[model samples]
Target: MDATGDVILVQGGGSVAATRQTSRTMKRTANLQERLQEKSHAVGERADAVVAPLHGGAGGESELADKAGKSQMLEDASGNNVSLMRTMLRAMLHETSTQLMDEQKKMLERLWDALMGNQRMTTQMMGEQLEMVRQLQQEVQAVKTQAVEESRKVDELRRLHEQSTRQLRVMQEQTSEQIRTTREQTTEQLKIIREQTAQNFEQMRLQVMKEVGIV
Candidate 1:
């Protein structure tokens, strides 16, 4: 009876130790499960930071392409304006040259007309001077002919005066000869009458003395 009692007590103590060891093992397993859940949440936050930068870079590249297209269009418009200005300048130069040529031709025509008018005036003046000289020569010749006719009439009048003086001297000599012949005939008749008268006176004295006796 004493050994049997000792074996029963020993078996009961062994059973109690076994139950305490099982309870310690269950507590260690619950702590390990909580640490694994915290590690998973950290990995999800890192992935979100990487994806945001890639999305922003794609939008920036599209904006740069639009600005380059606008710059090319402005350069083409400026080149067309320069070409139009050059064409207008060339046309103005051609019109100015044409006007200058017309003015030069008109000046030459005026000079030619002036020369022809001067030549006609010189010819008319020469003809008038020649006619005046011819008239003066004709007047001088008529005056010389009148002077010669007056000289011939003076010589004929001198010859008629000399013939009249010779006729007057011959008439005076004939009258003197006729007066001497008449005086000689009258003296002979007076001498015969004186002798007859003396004889008659003597006869008359003798007769008267006989009658009266006193004679």
Candidate 2:
């Protein structure tokens, strides 16, 4: 084949790959939005259902039904807005997670650069370099601690949400599979974050040690 033909083929392949990736991203976004809408609608339905059982079952059945109907209408309207907000919130979370990952990469690069700088240190500066390593280790530990705390908060929020979801399910007679799935997802995300942080920390330590000729 000619060089020009080869070039065209490569460009075409790249374009196809990029298009596929974009299509996947759009599909995922649409799925997330749909899930958010379902959740919002479910919450509203549960609320309306609960109100009727709580206030009816007597001579006030008609009145209760009317009130519940009105409440459901209001909830349905608000649910649309809530679903949009939740979709936006999920997008924000994805953006934040991506930013954190990028920050971690930048930090590791900086640490490697610092270690490279120390490779030319004389014997006299070895102790100082070791101290700097210690300081960096301490900083990494602090970051790990912060990450743990953040994971704890995330878990707490997940538990609270699960509890609320469970209560709603019990009130309306439903399943716990969705709750379990949500918890698992949250736990998996936290696990990934923790693993990445630890991996970066170890890499930094090893790099520092290599620079000091300890490895």
Candidate 3:
């Protein structure tokens, strides 16, 4: 087919492959985001539990009250620290996930570009190959035509040769017959002349004998 059509097919196949890869990357990214969100939620819940006020120890119990007071102060300090840590952890997870997704995006883009380049190269190679095949086919066709024409010419020459050969044979037979007829005619004329000469000599001898003889 045409180069444009082949290029379209290559591009179509490349796009499909790239799309599948992109979809997988997107799925992985979504999964990672979901997991990080769950982790952050868990951390938030734990921090809230730490910061929540403790129950019990209501009035008239000075020992219990003093113990509760000290425990409360320590817990408040620890809870604040845990909360701060949780916030930092959340920020870090968000930033890390964002960076990871951005990197994945860049990688997919590069892959897509690479695939397109390869497809274009493939299309060009295929076009060249097809063109070569077409040229070869045309050459083969021309060769076949030339061979046929040559064969026809050869056949015509053979026919003419055979005809000429037959005509020569006929002429030879006619010349040989004419020579035989002429030879026979010349032989018959010579035999007739010899017979007439012999008769004439016999008459002359008879006349001379008659004239010399006495009665």
Candidate 4:
């Protein structure tokens, strides 16, 4: 139970104990009062019976009157004392009850205020946790989006690399074909120049022989 409930439960136990104590006190007092009254009546009866024969009825008259008056006074005093005791008990009970009630009220108020304060704190903590969850979710979403963008860039880069590779292969094959054709042309030009030089040398030698024979 909460503090208020626990206090109320404890108070209930106290009230029960107080009630039992008061009941026992009242019962004991009532029994004592009955015994006292019975004893007083028995004493008065025995005294009258025993003393009546000891004197003539004329002398006993004043004494009997005195005894009766004393008994009556004792009964009155006892009654007054009983009344006073009852009044005192009632006052004590009332005061105790009032004090208990006041204390209980104060305790309940304090417990209620504490409960409310704890509730507010719990609510604030829950709100903070919810906000944290929202922020974490946003961060997770941002990370997912960034990862997707990076993946897309990697795919684009792969496509570009494949295209560049194909273009480089085609250029290399074209350059190799050009180099082979230039090599064949250069060999054919060298062969034709060598044949022309040989014919020119043979003609110069015959013209020199004719000049020599004429001289």
Candidate 5:
């Protein structure tokens, strides 16, 4: 028998080397067993051929022929029994080999399924991780945008405060200048009033002196 069929059956199914080795071993063993069986059968045939004619009795050739027939029948039965044993052993070996092959197939299937499941889970996890990273990036971008907006608002407020401060300084300076101008104007007006009052008093004195007839 060729082990190639068995080798092909196990190809790409996983455990190829072991299966091939086992197949070769099984083939060798089967061949050996078959050779042994053939040898046994040949020995039985030769023995029967040799022993069938040895029982000659006083009944002469008929008795001898009957004994030969009986021996032949016994040999045939023994051969049948041997053939049955070989068939049974072959069936047992076939069953065992089939069972082993089935187990290997099932194991390989389970491993494949597990590997696929793991790969799927790993891919899903990587996807989830990528999504999380994307979300994190978005969040970081949002935070940066918010920070920029806040910074811009702070800058606007600082500018406004500076402008207000400048306006306040300008107003204070203008108020001081206006107060100084008012003080100067009041002083000049008071000087003019004093001079006019003095002039009028002098004129009144002259008029009184002239009216007193000292002209």
Candidate 6:
């Protein structure tokens, strides 16, 4: 009996020691799992801190590119404005030159017209003077012809007057000679007639005395 009782006590004591050992191993495994979880969280925080600078650098570069693009656009707009102003000025100058040329052409045409009018007036006056000279020359020729005719008529009248004076002198000389001849003939005839009458009267007286015996 002592030997059996002693064996049972020993077995019970061994079982109790095995149970305490198992409880201690389970407590150690739990503490190790908590430590591993804490280590994983810390590693994730360290990786986030290292990649933060790369993201910030990329964002800053994008902002700088946007500002440069805006500056280039402003410069292009200013250049376009300068070109527009130059074009406008050139157009204005061309218009002014055209207007001046038109005015000069008009003035030249007016001057030409005036010169032509003056030339026509001068020609008309010259023609009038020539006509007047021709008329005066014709009148002078007519007067010269009239003077020649008058001189010829005066010469003819003087010749007729000289011939009439010579005929009158010859007739007066012939009449005086005829009257002297007639007076001589009449005296001779009267002498002869008186002689004959005296002879006849003497004869008749003698005859008468003888017949009467007293003579």
**C-alpha TM-scores of all predictions:** 0.25, 0.27, 0.53, 0.54, 0.57, 0.36
Worst 10 residues of 2 by lDDT: 1-10
lDDT value, residue 116 of candidate 6: 88
- For residue 45, what is the lDDT in candidate 5? 74
- For each candidate, how many residue pairs have backbone atoms clashing (under 3 Å)? 0, 0, 0, 0, 0, 0
Stronger candidate by lDDT (2 vs 4): 4
lDDT of 5 by residue, 1-215 (tens): 34445544655555666475567567756875786678667766776676556555445776677667767766776677678777866775676577667867887898999999999999999999999999999999999999999999999999999999999999999999999999999999999998998999999888988999766
Per-prediction CA RMSD (Å):
54.8, 59.0, 12.5, 8.5, 6.1, 49.5
Scored against the true structure, residue 166 in model 6 reaches a CA lDDT of 68
Worst lDDT window (10 residues) for model 1?
Answer: 1-10
Question: In model 5, where do residues sit more than 4 Å from their true spots?
Answer: 1-54, 57-93, 204-215
Could you give candidate 2's per-residue lDDT for residues 38-92 as a string of tens digits?
A: 8767767766675665564555776777677767776776776677766776775
Model 2 residue runs over 4 Å out of place are: 1-14, 54-215
Candidate number with the higher TM-score (2 or 3): 3
Cand. 3 TM to true fold:
0.53
Error of 1 at 105 (Å): 3.7
Off by over 4 Å in 3: 1-70, 179-215
- Model 5 local distance difference test score: 0.77
Indicate which candidate wins on TM-score: 5
| Model 6 Cα lDDT, one tens digit per residue, 157-183 | 777767666666666666666666665
Query: How much does candidate 5 score in TM-score?
Result: 0.57
**True lDDT of residue 208, candidate 3:** 83
lDDT per model, in order? 0.46, 0.70, 0.68, 0.72, 0.77, 0.55
The pairs that clash in candidate 1 are none
lDDT comparison, 2 vs 6, better candidate: 2
